[model samples]
Target: MTYTHESKKPTAARREAQKAFREADAKVAMSEYERNQKAFHANRERLRSERLAREAAATAKAAQSESADHVRKKRIVS
Candidate 1:
């Protein structure tokens, strides 16, 4: 009995399958990256808005106290 030696051959179907897999992987990666970026920006915006609100509240309170003090001082002097 004689056995034939194996030969290296490239197949079209295998190449097509490999190409499809690469494309699918790229799309999945891009989608995941976009999702992460969206979450990050959302969190950043939320933090910034919260900080601005706190600052505004503080400013309003300080202004009110200063106005009250001014009235008291004027009344005492007059």
Candidate 2:
């Protein structure tokens, strides 16, 4: 007679418990990922808005200076 060593599979209840723990851990990880992503997107949006406002202000200033120069040239011509 030959004796063989075999590995035993986990019982159904143990498998179920492992599955539940894995699912709970995955949910926690996903929530943390979502929170970080939201914060990143919010910061990016805020920076983009600030950049747009600065550009608008610069454009407005340039246009005002150009208009003033045009008026001065007209007065000189007259």
Candidate 3:
């Protein structure tokens, strides 16, 4: 008995299955990328807000100290 050689071309069903698998894989990858991007932006925004709060506190402290100094100088000169 002689066996037939394998065909070089894939069957239509196999091609359809491969295409579906590739599309699913790409969809999963895109969702993962979006998740990572959202996390990154959230972290960046948190850091920015924290920095601004610290700067505001520092500015308020400096202004308070400067005003206190002015009051002390007036009492001393009188």
For residues 1-78, write the lDDT of model 3, one tens digit per residue: 999998789889999999999999999999999999999999999999999999999999999999999999999999
- Candidate 2 to truth, TM: 0.79
Model 2 error, position 46 (Å): 0.5
Between the candidate structures 1 and 3, which one is better when assessed by TM-score?
A: 3
Off by over 4 Å in 3: 1-7
Model with the higher lDDT, candidate 2 or 3: 2
Q: Which sections of candidate 1 miss by over 4 Å? A: 1-10
* Backbone clashes in model 3, listed as residue pairs: none
- Tell me each candidate's TM-score: 0.76, 0.79, 0.77
TM-score-better candidate, 1 vs 2: 2
- Per-candidate local distance difference test: 0.97, 0.99, 0.99
lDDT value for candidate 2?
0.99
Q: Candidate 1 residues 1-78, lDDT tens each?
A: 999999867599988998999999999999999999999999999999999999999999999999999999999999
Give the clashing residue pairs of candidate 1, or none.
Answer: none
Candidate 2 wrong stretches, greater than 4 Å: 1-6
